[model samples]
Target: MRILSGMRPTGKLHIGHLVGALENWVRLQEEGNECFYFVADWHALTTHYDDVSRLKEYTRDLVRGFLACGIDPEKSVVFVQSGVKEHAELALLFSMIVSVSRLERIPTYKEIKKELNYKDLSTAGFLIYPVLQAADILIYKAEGVPVGEDQVYHIELTREIARRFNHLYAEVFPEPDAILSRVPKLPGTDGRKMSKSYGNIINLEISEIELERTILRMMTDPARVRRTDPGNPENCPVWRYHQAFDISEEESKWVWEGCTTAKIGCVDCKRLLLKNMKKKLIPIWENFSRIDEDPRYVDDVILEGTKRAREVARQTMEEVRKAMNLMF
Candidate 1:
């Protein structure tokens, strides 16, 4: 089955990105499925259009991160969203099929408005992002889209658009289903959602010294002021990291019991979590080093992927033109 997904080229990825999407992408490829992963440079504009001078640089960094995280270019079609013009064409055609009232109804639209706190989010491009996303999926006629629960609504919208297009003209697309990933929400050192915007993320390519320092400084249970005071592991953000990274239940059990009974201090608990976490990231760290050593290799990989992707995209667009009677 053909699967498609993308991430905005915002900045360097953190642990949240690893568990949330990259790992899932690698698993799908290893399972012998066709995967199309791209740097969503165009999507980044829906919000960050004000400053794009660094956009190209960020896009390159995003691809490097993708490669470092084990997204084999040989097994997956990886490219930049803006590299293929068909995405824009399909998105424009899809815009006519979807209603303004419908776009306004999407829950995320309101959320974005609030998040940005911009008095006027009336930009046509921003409003139609869901339509653009639909183009990203249907242009490939993708069978499945791996996403978190927050994105299920967009998948529903995509299915509706596909159904509308097929009903109006021809069966040119397969309605893609949302494959919800089992991604744990990793918190930052500040005890907030691990986000670059928050300045508390532990980057994927961070040096060992920085990684250790960040883990050591991470927020723990605030109520347990003294080492002797019994702590609540449930309230500690560090405990969350332990649960997400520690593979052995026995180790997790040890951390839980030790923390709850005052047998272990916050520093000790963090040291254990850091130990388990470092082993998981060793390969990614090595890959990051390799990518830095040879930058041109990353460029070659994206170019090759774009070449392969364009071939399929062109075929799909031909069918799309015929379905809409635009063959002339």
Candidate 2:
């Protein structure tokens, strides 16, 4: 399957990113599927256009995160979205075919507008991002898009756009399907959705000491105010981490029995969870350290991948032009 997915270079990636998306991406690439992963720099502009001083820095960190998490550049095409100009051209062409009402109806667009109400999100670019996303997937003629549940609607819209384009012009693009991730969303330390804005994220580049402190401070079952009080693991955010990190069956059973029976205190449970998490995250941090030190290596990877992506994108644009009678 030709799979494509991307992430905005808004800030440093967090543990939520590692398990929620990066792990899944690495699994897909290892499964022998063709993958195209790009940093959505243009998409970042939809929200962070006001201050772009750190845009290049964030982009570099994002690529580092990708490589550190085992997204092998040799196996997958990793590039920047704006590096290939075809994405902008395709998005412009798609805008004419898609309705303003359709874009307005997208749940994410409405949700983001509310979430970032402080920001001036009244721009046309902010509203039509889904159209650009469609261009991102369709430009590569991707058969499947690896996305979380929140993004399934965007893939649906992409399919609609593909169908419309084919109906109006010619069959040049595939109606891509959403390959839903099996992993559930990882929560922030504060037990809410992990977001940079929340300031509750555990970034991938966090120090071991900070990781320990963060995990130790994670929110637990609110009902259990005293150490003597029995706790429900279901309501405890630490327990959720244990589950996400794949704590062994024996250890999991111990945690469940202990939490419900008041045999284990929240601190001890958190300590155990911390140990298990470190085993998984330490290697990724090490990989990131080596990659971060070598900026040239990161540049070479992006340069090569962008060139390769442009080759495929150019061919797609040619077919699109011929279908729409834009070719001279």
Best candidate (score: TM-score): 2
**Candidate 2 C-alpha lDDT tens digits along 212-306:** 88888889999889998998999987887898787999999999999999999999999889888989998998898788787698889999999
Error of 1 at 143 (Å): 1.5
- What is the Å distance of residue 141 in model 1 from its true position? 1.4
Residue-pair clashes per candidate, as listed? 0, 0
The TM-score of candidate 1 is 0.95
Residue range 1-328, candidate 1, lDDT tens digits: 9999999987777888887788888988899999999998999998888889889999988999899999999899999999999999999999999999999999999987987785466789899999999999999999999886778999999999999999999999999999866663677888886666689888887888999999998889988899998888888888777767754888888888888898989898888888888988998888888888985988998899988888899999999999898965
Collision pairs in model 2: none
**lDDT, candidates in the order shown:** 0.88, 0.92
- The 10 consecutive residues of candidate 2 with the worst lDDT sum are 179-188
